[model samples]
Target: MSTWMVTGGAGYIGSHVVEAFRAQGIGVVVVDDLSSGHEAFVPADVPFVRTDVQDREAVAAALDEHRVQGVVHLAGFKYAGVSVTRPLHTYTQNVTGTVALLQAMADAGTTDIVFSSSAAVYGTPTVDLVTETTPTLPESPYGESKLVGEWLLRDQARALEGTSTPLRHTSLRYFNVVGSGHDHLYDTSPHNLFPLVLDALVQGRTPTVFGTDYPTPDGTCVRDYVHVADLATSHVAAARALEGGHDLAPVYNLGSGDGVSVRQIMSAVASVTGTPFTPQEAPRRPGDPARIVASGELAARDLDWQMRHTLEQMVESAWRARQAAEAATP
Candidate 1:
């Protein structure tokens, strides 16, 4: 069986990608620093290396040991708002981390990579629906770092154009990734909207909606939320496409093209959790886009991407998982 290395595989999205790969009968070796990932999230049977992606020697060793065919790079600092306050940290984790991982791949002669990028690359987009052709105007250090990560992949590939081990790469720019494909694996992100709302309700606290003065119809931030599982499916597809010698766009947006506002998400949380409480409004957060929705036409055409889960389903599953997590907590 061909094994692939998944950086941040113990993380919420990375864990789901691990599961998706396992479901497809693919072998996986997980490498995570556990800074934000949970060791329990990884399956006991799968191989795991507890280290940061910046540890090029350790990552290269793992790749060689496991005979990894490719890599799904998802390990990095992901908080857009927090990145504004900690630019250096963001660049170190996202940019320097990517550089180290790419270096490790070169060492191990692993040529294929699927980068887990964010929609933040197209910061506060001007178009109604973002596409692959959209201009990249990163507003935060996190966004800028992700863009630089993509550039690294392209530049590395270009440098190895005539080499024995030519790099094959793709970056999947995800919008708001939510929902629980499995109740056992829910999002635990403190900065993410879904987890924040769910955590508030779980603790009998009112969920606070940050920024109600955005330039959207609801006067709140609008985002294109995609189910985490659906998003994971495309990561695997991208990996397979590269391994199969199939050409793909350097970047693909895994967006819904359907805008959902914070108020709407609050409403969904209220309805799904059977807790009808108005969310407390707050000032607009730093580095938050007023609205961002993107067309997944490119990914759908190439990587079998589609919105399989509805908004209602997303909230319901997340609530279910949150409850499960609470019950399991000591």
Candidate 2:
């Protein structure tokens, strides 16, 4: 079995990846400081180390001890608005943490990596579907940090001499990631729309729609929300490809293939739960794009990836998981 190290395996996306790997009978280890992620979310069988990715020594030791063949780096602050408000923290976590992780990987002879990037790097795209070749003009610190991380990975690979070991990296730029796990681990992100809507609905409250006068047909911000399970599968595929000697720094975009508006999301939730719902409209938030969908054709063709869940399936699954968690609570 191939051994892998997941940097933020306790977080939402990381945990999903961890479960996916374990389900495939692969050996996995996790390193997370639990600053934002929960320990309860991590699988019980997989080995875990509670430590910061910035701690070079700790990360290196984990890699070596686990004999990690590759890494999936997913630990970083992801809130776009918060990143704009706190640029320094965003840089430190996304950029500095990546540097530290790369150094540790180098020290441990772990050269293959699957990076978690974002479509925010595309900023305000002129077209509805953004291709990987689109100009990167990140509008927020979070986006800038991710783009810089991508550059760092490429540069690190390019700088390797013939005698030195090569670093192969795949950066998967994902749009908004949503949905819930079978275990129903409460994801702690206050920015993502899916969980926020689920939270508000469970409390018998009206969900907030930040922008209702957007240029889209629904008059609300539209985004491509890919299910977390499909996203996790993409990471697994990328890792396997790199391990099989794919001599390229493959960059792929993960999306739902279409856009979903805030109003439509509310409608989906209401339909799933069989409840009449209305959203509270608020002024448009900064950095809010009218529509942001990705061209996942490359990912599908190269990685053999396909989004299996429909929009209704995503909402219903999330609702079921959230309700189960609430019912299980004392």
Candidate 3:
């Protein structure tokens, strides 16, 4: 069996990607520093290396030792609002870490990779539906770092062109990824919407909506929310395509074409959790966009992308996993 290394395999999305790879009968090596990732998320059967991705020598050694054929890179500082205050930390983790990871891949002769990029690369796009061709003008340090990661992949591939082991890569620009692929692996980000609301509910507090006067249909900011499981499936597909020698676009947007309002999400959470409480509305935050959705046509064509779960299902899955995680916490 061919083995691949997952840089953030112990993280929420990265763990789900690891599960997807295992489901498909592929060998996986997990590497995570556990700064934001949980040590318990990695399976006992999979070989795991706990280290910072910026440690190129450590990562390269793991790859060489495991005979890794490819990599799925998802390790980074992911909070956008926090990134503003911690710009240096964000760049060091996302940008510099990616550079080191690429060097490690080169050292280990791992030619194929799937980069976990973000929709923030669009930086509040003016278009109704963002596509692969959308102009990238990142607004935050986190978004800028993700965009730089994609550029590194592209430039590295070009630099290795005609070489015996040229880099094969693609960046998956993900939108608001929510929900859970397994009962054991749930999103733990304190900054994300689902978790914030869920945590508030868990604490017997009402969840508050930051803004309620946006130009969206429901007067709330609209976003494209994709289920993490479905997103994970596409990562595996991307890895498969790269290794199969299929031509793919340099970047693909993993998103839902239809946008959902924050109010709608709150309603779904209420309905799914059977907790009826109106969300406290507040003034719009700075830089919040009215509507941000993307077209997944390109990903669908190449990566088998599709919206596999409904809004209610997304909320329900996330809530269940959150409860599971809470119960497991000692």
Candidate 4:
């Protein structure tokens, strides 16, 4: 069996990927520091190392010890606003950490990688539906760091690939990742839109909606929200594609193929929670695009990717998980 190393496997999306891989009876070793990830999310049977991905030596040791054949690089700081506040930290975590991971992979003779990229790379796209050929003009450090990471992977792949060894990689660009598991592992980030709304609804407080008068159909910002499970499926598919000797570290967008306005999401949340909560409108957030939808054509054709979850399903699952989490709290 091919052993795999999943960085940030204890994180929200990473944990889902870990579960999916285990369900398929694939060997997986997780490396996480629990900074943004939760240890409780990590599976008990899978081998885990509590270490940073930037620690090259530690990562190398983990790779060698786990006999890793490939890596699903999912470790990175993803908060867009926070990245604006701490650009250096974002670069260090997203870019520098990836550099260290690639070096460690090279050292361990692990050549395959599937990177967890984001839609933030297409900052303020001029086109409504973003494609693989869309220009990458990231507005914040978070997106910039991911773009830089992609460049680094491409460069390293070019430098290392030959007859003896080959470096193959795939970067999956995920849109807004919503939804939660049955186990109640909700998102820890207070910055995410879904969690923020859920938290406010749980507290009987009004959720804040930024920019109500955008150019979108609902007069609010629109985004392509992809279910977390769909995103996780793309990751595994990307890994399997690379393991099959696919060359070039191509980028693929993961979205629902349709855009949902903020108002639509708010309505869905209210319907799911059975609460008539109104949103407090505010000025637009910096670096936020008016409307951002993606064409999942590449993902569909290449990885056989199709989102099985809808926005309603995502909202309902999130509400269920949030209620479960709150009920469990002391």
Measured by TM-score, the strongest candidate is 1
Cα lDDT of all candidates, in order? 0.95, 0.86, 0.93, 0.86
State TM-scores per candidate: 0.99, 0.97, 0.97, 0.97
RMSD of each: 0.6, 1.2, 1.2, 1.3
lDDT of 2: 0.86
How does model 4 score by TM-score? 0.97
The number of clashing residue pairs in model 1 is 0
- Cα deviation at 9, candidate 1, in Å, is 0.4
lDDT digits (tens) for residues 1-330 of candidate 2: 789899899998899999888877888999999988988888788898999899999999988988899999999998887888899999999999999999988888888899999998988889878888888988999989999999999888877646356898989998988776565754558888888888898888888999889898989988998888888888888888898997543588887678888898889888888888778888987766678888788899777678888889888778777888889889
Clashing pairs in 2: none
Query: Which 10 residues in a row give candidate 2 its minimum summed lDDT?
Result: 179-188
Highest-lDDT candidate: 1
lDDT of 4 by residue, 1-330 (tens): 887888999888999888878777789999999898988888889999999999999999989988888999999998887788899999999999999999998888888999888899999899878998999999988989999988988999889868366688888898899897545566767788999999998888999998988877878989998777777777777777788776533888886779998989999998888898778999987768788899998888887678888788999888888888888889
Q: What's the lDDT for residue 116 in model 4?
A: 89
Overlapping backbone residue pairs in candidate 4 total: 0
